[model samples]
Target: MSRVVSRGLSAASGMLGGALAGAIFKQVWKLASGKEEAPQATSEEYGWREVLVAAAVQGAIFGMVKAAIDRSAAQSIHRATGK
Candidate 1:
């Protein structure tokens, strides 16, 4: 069904976005805290392992946040619709 496919795609997109945000957030945190000594390099200089780990963390955070947001949004919409 198109609905099922759309749901799957939405989930995949959410995970990917979360992972990307997490990785960037991790890198930015490092840079901001002065933990990273060298200037930032391009993606070619960054390894996959670091990115994967960051993405995992980010995905988890995003998942939790997304759940809360969805719940609240659903509740608000339901109330508006008198459902």
Candidate 2:
């Protein structure tokens, strides 16, 4: 496949992963804190403080996982090319 297609797939995968991570993290936090499980009305409703805190934690974890998968994929490509 072309590099453009590969990049697009990678991007879509990363975005999906990030969104899933964020949702799971938010729910887990709410559950652990004994808070209600209802979804917020808007991103702003959570406020920057809570949003940023959750975002940072979830983003870091998701970023690491995404990077690992990307790195492994690159390695496989390199190995296939005998590089």
Candidate 3:
């Protein structure tokens, strides 16, 4: 209920959400590409198009997860503090 506790909860939620998003992305990429490994933007083996696409997908997933987690945390904090 305190500010410290609320911030701590938000931080923890963000970490958990990021990890979940990464795992989800890996599974999604595997299914979509039929490959075990996702393309890396810095890797020399992958073409520019492949690398860019991978980066875009990864960014989108991370952004969505972060936003969702942040929103949920904010709502929960508001309910707890009535502020």
Cα TM-score per model: 0.44, 0.52, 0.90
Candidate 3 C-alpha lDDT tens digits along 4-82: 8878887788889989999989998898888889987678998998878878898999999999888887788789779
lDDT of 2 by residue, 1-83 (tens): 67897799788877876777667666766775566543343655676666566656666767776777678777876887766
Q: What is the lDDT of residue 49 in candidate 2?
A: 66
Over the stretch 26-69, how does candidate 1's per-residue lDDT look in tens digits?
Answer: 67657644555322434666577655655565566667766765
**Cα deviation in Å at residue 26, candidate 1?**
5.5
Please give the TM-score that candidate 2 achieves against the real structure: 0.52
| Model 1 spans > 4 angstroms off | 1-42
Model 3: lDDT equals 0.86
Computed on alpha carbons, the lDDT of every model, listed in order, comes to: 0.61, 0.68, 0.86
Best by TM-score: 3
Instruction: Please give the range of 10 consecutive residues that has the lowest summed lDDT in model 2.
Output: 32-41
Q: Candidate 2, after superposition: displacement of residue 74 in Å?
A: 1.2
Q: What's the C-alpha lDDT at position 52 in model 2?
A: 63
**Runs in model 3 lying further than 4 Å from the true structure:** none
